[model samples]
Target: MSSGSALIPLDRALARLLDGLGPVAAETAALPDAAGLVAAETLHAPRALPVRPLALRRGIAVASADLVGATPHAPALLPSAPPVVLGGDVLPEGADAVLPADAAATSGPFHEIGQSAYPGEGAVLPGTDLTDGAVIVAAGAPITAEAVLALQLAGIAELTVRRPRIALMGDAAGAEAAWLKARLARAGCAVTDAAPADLVLHLARDPAAVVAGPGLALQPGGDAALLVDGTSRTLVLAPRADALVAALFALVFPVVAVLQGRRLATVARALTRNMASQVGLADLALLRHTPEGWEPLGVGRVTLMAILAADAVAILGPESEGAAAGAPIAAIPLQEPFDPR
Candidate 1:
């Protein structure tokens, strides 16, 4: 008796949809324990590194005044002395610095009656090792073995991070959920709490199972994103799931996405910042394709650019083209490979 609601073409809707997700950052996030995690934070030095002057070799601390006229043939004599170990603190009282224990042979006393020690010829003095406020490491520095050593020497106990949150809702756990969770956590998210997550990942062996699952049945609260994997039964719940998918697509990716374009050398960067301690690349991809269509370009199967524009939708996979009116369409996102650099 009456025709169904006119289908909203994919192209126009998608452009509008992706444009709304807001601007993606120029740089992405990396795992906490990985090398990139330390680079993103404002890491400052705890104090002057080394804390004190360090002797480079095993030497004896001698006062400059005591070494005057001392030579290989006839050395000055003084009192008993101790051998300085490498990295030991150098004293300034009488010893200007440290002389290798084997460098000079001592016959008599350690110090002479009236000797003169030249400046800068002896062991290291206090405050000469390192100065305060000297930058041991700069901010946004990538964590390296050297950097770790520097931090440890500086006495830095902990670090701060911006980790992202990820949740998976699948029919059952085997490998897919594990794989998906790994990926999400890498994208600057903290894979911590699952109940009522910041991002709700819905996976089903069958499409209908998505709606029947507790994830869809319960009205999710908070600002959470849903990633749905298309299944055979997925098409069965087409009416409801499709609308939800459409709405979510719009929310995630709005129309006319624009970054500040430049004429030349306008290299764009996209980085995800997280506070969590653990992250992995399995959860985060630079590109992807969902059942809703190409991610960040939500054009569905029948997308349209303009009235005169040719149809840009292409069915590349084994699946056939076009579903019957009221036919369920699966929602799988086209994924882009993620590079963790």
Candidate 2:
């Protein structure tokens, strides 16, 4: 039987994509917390992790050799020793390890004269827990709290990661108004609204704005993607920005019929499939202010319609369009644009 759409289950789709693409990383969040996030590269141990054995409990320090001579009947008297606190490093010279206060009779000195003590029987061995330059975690591994702790223990300073970024355009567009820029910045992304943006966001209050943004965004060939989301609607499409308006008119609808004074269907079948591995959309801004009035103009028409639809769209606009709406887009050729908003 033929299905209406070749739809793979969401879980199945994710699994396939993950398997093919491998682990994707976000920017390096601080260690001791950003566990589960993919490591940018291999991180080496700063010095030696757990450089020394931490005492498990409060106790007295004693040398394994010192206890060699003790016996049950004629027990050697142990010399008076200071109390060792938990986490204290046991010195290797005289004390092989520490004896828990509860386990030893500290009231009297322990003295052994004739017997021998076993090696490593009473103390922590150096480099047993972990050694220096050990690969604590690998690249593409998910960061977890435990991993964060391990990184901290390993003494990692700065971590390299794929930082999230968003480019903005729309009816009410402004470089400062880019929510993703602000959000990512707050979340520790060195953000920029420049072209070749990691992502693009078509943030307008209406569908019309979305259309305009897509028209503008789909210019740099069909390689970069577009995402439009707001008010229970999200459209992932790719439109050829480089394609002339006349070419689109020829492809989607018959301009000749319209010229002949026939009002054809307003909706055109001009959609480009999403070639993105990951697509995310969010209405972080629940706007309610009704626009007084706006006449559709140039690319702004899409933004205006969105205002009428009471919905918004975010598109991964062209990398060049970083200036305020009216201003010119940048000159750089945008690549790998992102729209994680």
Candidate 3:
């Protein structure tokens, strides 16, 4: 592929790369394997939660009318047939309320109710937790742990989600591939070698040697080129492993948004220090934590060891000139020990 060395704005480059890419197709997956995947369609509760009224405490299920006139001193005796119920148990067929065990006295077969009972007291009614046909998760939403549990509790055995397939074709021996694989795995993408991948990334020594495709090319000198030729897309970056990895933070979310049908903007954690932008180009600077605060490492000094030593990265927008000390900027944390203060 012919390569042109033009310094395109980061935002414009990302928009071009993500313009036509979208969730591949819907597929079924079990609840446990659904975490981090994007929902392909809105998931609705098939049935109301707690089909029957559920007891909320350890008590005797009794009709509320039976304890209407009951008092502490002059207690009302409950019928011997009232079933003993524990917390989270379904209320018995004939019971409309629960009389707490501690609030009643038992003698032989009869249980005395010392307090008044109210209908629906100490019980969760049908659909209280989730209503039938209500949306459990909206389309394009990420499936989180909480969402998984909710789906399981709602009796959903399987869900349809979009698992984007990404292929890594270069720099196998470098940290960039490893880091990208790990990051995509954490984001619930399936990295595979299957033909016609949703996205392909190539690392090259010479910008002119990049694979022929419709994609964006990023170089170490802050130059970017966008090539569009139908569905064939690729991203070419300079083989400086550490700086390439740092610059990737600005691109990952946009890629995810395209593959998951999400409307998310490229965002990073808030920066812990001020950052200076290049005169005409956006800047992606690696940051390390020190006893004083967070500081930006020199762009030329970003090596694999230096990247491993850093805890975050600060991204200066194209519009801004520089950030004052303590000014909040967007940052991408590379490891733990990231403190915003």
Candidate 4:
């Protein structure tokens, strides 16, 4: 209310936030700690996943050629079978197969191979688990649980990834600020207190103060602003407790996309009722996904009740006039992915 700057479009505001910003420098992280981050570049296996043949069962390793023609009727007697290897153990140098406990019998200090064995019987041949030259993780892929599993299986302990570091500039102890911190982390940001962070989120609610930043055109959050200095971008969020969340998706989330090179997930849902929006300003619609479709809770400065009742949000861009009943819209999901509802 104090700044006389003209209100800027939401997209323009986001673009200003990204004016000179780029993905932060890549850092090496242990595989276990890399989850929820984006890979800096495509990664290939450093070596074969399992460098040697692997025993798939608890049994004696054997040279398959030596067991040909051997059977219960005419067992091939041997001084000893190849060295014993358990599940997950590497087959010994002289062994090409794993003879199950039932396949071998001991007779007068001699190990008898009673069943024939093939070269790869009961064993995973070398490079079969994951080839030596296969791609371990593609560029820009999220370091998810599955991706981490494959990396670990490939004997990789670390990865190079891009994790934007953000500095919180406002009421870090306030409930709204804490919520913002958590959501930012889920978007693959490292929230911290000091300098060197790639971005800063300044939370303020001082109505008497005149600040210099972008003229935010978002309803319920138009008072917020964006401050740019050198390579540092600070997002000033004047979040009334009820407007905290709506303001974030409206102003802050898009910057994450610019840095990480990926978009946050959204689910398509049909609106349950008509939702009208101003043609000139961006609108934030809080919603509850019901059995039939999305039930609009409230738009603009929604109530605490509206926030609690909501499970997702739909942002009507600056160019839009909102949607009619049964109109499908892309919404940012606020609940866990496994919600039964």
Candidate 5:
């Protein structure tokens, strides 16, 4: 449905929302509190652990050359050897490998060498434990449990992470605003009800009324829009029964993804029925799984009751008119379609 000439294409609106939008301010969070937060800076390994090769078994350290050609049939006698134990010793001076205990024997002052010491045999080499300057976490990547453990082993006590602040203002308690708020929170945004926010979500009961002061192509009685509030980016939602969800996904979600420096991911599925859309406007579709394939529950204006039964959602770009039945379309999952026990 055409709102008016004032309505910008979803892609252009997203570009305007993302133009020069860097990450929000960075804060130092202790390692324990870092998981689920976005890394503001890349962290590198502080040092190489076990700087030298360490023994992998109970053994004697010796120059590999000293054991060359030595075998049980032709034993090479050494004056003495430095003792190395598993988890307790490094390769001794002048030693390049570990000769396992069974490979050598004590004979008075000479240590009998009965096996050739293959290079790197019976021992782990330097950096086998950790390498210096290796990337632990890249900037814009989420801090995960595995990442946290790596950082701990790398001696990182804390990390620099970015948490975008969002001001979620709803005209009243409604399912649409609640859904949007929960989605944003799950995306790692810190939600508030005050100023000083990196983003503002202004939800209005009137599908096309301005609760937040007007500017930036938005009409007092028009469609939902993205506008600026000083340095804060504001998203005004005209919560029309049919239009609310389309705005939430196409405009709001992408804006938040940019704030966190990420791209929205989608899964591909074959459509069960042909979909139709306005060529110049992005269309939102809600879908459900059926025996044949994925089927659209509703397109464009969808009832909340219809939305509840959906398994996935897809936002068709403005460049697309629609797709024929059985064609693959990218969709975003609201929940797992097939539960794996």
Candidate 6:
């Protein structure tokens, strides 16, 4: 169902959705649960990693000066003062280097070294991995698995992050709504119908219908329109569930990022099929991953079959023309793979 209204550019539509919007309030989340959420504040390392100097190998700790003349033929005998150490053990006092077990022969309490030992060799010094007060995660940065690992290594148990409360109101029984709800939930947003929503998305079939309050209204059929103020902002999309879901993801992802106080990341992949431009209107075409590469499904041919066979969606901007086959284009992959076969 195409709306008679002129199509708004994709970038312009997103800008409208982001107008007057701010980041959601920060809340404390456990480190494990903080993945995918935006950091509300800068996280600093409370203490240095490793905590102290650690041996890197199983060997004898000794003064580097004693091993200056060590060679394969004339191996230097280490003083029977310091004790042997294993990997990850703390170096003994007054020992500045470690002679690896392979390079040293143990005889009673003394060890024979065949190689020169350099100070700080075969050992990790304190603060080498992470220093105290260093920024682990900057504000507005996404908490990734690597970030989580770093935080855990730095002994961080919890973190403050922006968890936006998004309200999903529409055809609750419809597959599109359910899919959108799950996607939003996976994006770290709290999806509910309770009052005081940071943003509301009303999914309707009618393009002219108005919804209460100021929010976005998505109409799946034809050309999409994003209206502001008390007026309804309806997005006309294809009737097929796959088409509708692709359209919803393309429109809502940026809005969620704006609300979370983070910039949306753009990812592009090679397109397997040709995609024609819509001139003024922005188009999101579903894609399927084949052995050849990513194949874009035609917009007019979008159906449950096409959706089921697709794994991603390629977005064509308003300013650009159609893309030829095998051209790299921006795309978003479906969270779960769809197998049409």
The most accurate candidate by TM-score is: 4
Worst 10 residues of 1 by lDDT: 275-284
Instruction: Estimate, for each residue in 1-341, the C-alpha lDDT of model 3 and write its tens digit.
Output: 22322456667777877777777788899978898777888888899997888898888787787888889888888657468899899998757677767776777888777788888898877778788898878887778788888899988988998777776666645766677677776665787644367776555655445644322322233432245457766666555665466445666556765677765432234345666655445556777766555677644235666677777765556566666666554555664211211
lDDT of each: 0.35, 0.36, 0.66, 0.76, 0.70, 0.67
Query: Which model scores highest in lDDT?
Result: 4
Question: Against the true structure, candidate 1 has what lDDT?
Answer: 0.35
Q: Which stretches of candidate 2 lie over 4 Å from their true place?
A: 1-37, 69-71, 77-83, 88-94, 102-124, 167-196, 203-209, 212-341
Candidate 4, lDDT over the whole model: 0.76
Score candidate 5 by lDDT: 0.70
Model 1 over residues 1-341: C-alpha lDDT tens digits? 01111322233323333333432233433322533232344555655544444555456666666666877556666666545555456553545556656654444555332333454444445445445555543433334556566556566655544332334444426553454445344333445434353334444445434444221211111112233342110111122332233322332212111211101111122211211111110011111223442222222221222212321111111122222323333332223112212
Ten residues in sequence with the least summed lDDT for candidate 3: 212-221
Q: In candidate 6, what are the lDDT values of residues 1-341, reduced to their tens digit?
A: 23313544456666767677777779999978898777889999999877867788888787787888889888788656456799889887667667655777777877677778787887877788898899888887778788899999888999999888876555556766777677787676888864357666655665345433322222223433345563223343323464456456667676677667766554567777777765544556777777767787665345777767877766665455678888887666665221111
User: Against the true structure, what is each candidate's TM-score?
Assistant: 0.42, 0.42, 0.74, 0.79, 0.63, 0.70
The clash count of every prediction, one per candidate, is 71, 37, 0, 0, 1, 6
What shift in Å separates residue 207 of candidate 5 from its native position after superposition? 6.5
Model 4 / residue 144 / CA error / Å: 3.1
Full ranking by lDDT:
4, 5, 6, 3, 2, 1
To one decimal, what is the Cα RMSD in angstroms of model 4 from the true structure? 4.6
Relative to the unseen true structure, what is the C-alpha lDDT of residue 177 in candidate 4, on a scale of 0 to 100? 80
Give candidate 6's whole-model lDDT: 0.67
lDDT of 5 by residue, 154-271 (tens): 7899988777888877673676667767766666678788767887877775434563332222122136756764576777775554555666566666666667666566778899
lDDT of 4 by residue, 91-110 (tens): 88867899877777779989
lDDT of 3: 0.66
Candidate 1 wrong stretches, greater than 4 Å: 1-41, 62-82, 87-99, 111-149, 175-188, 206-341
Candidate 2, residues 234-319, lDDT tens digits: the string is 22222322221211221111211221122223211111221121122100110111232111122312232333442222222222
What RMSD does each model have against the real structure?
15.2, 18.2, 5.7, 4.6, 6.8, 6.1
Ranking according to TM-score, highest score first: 4, 3, 6, 5, 2, 1
RMSD of 1: 15.2
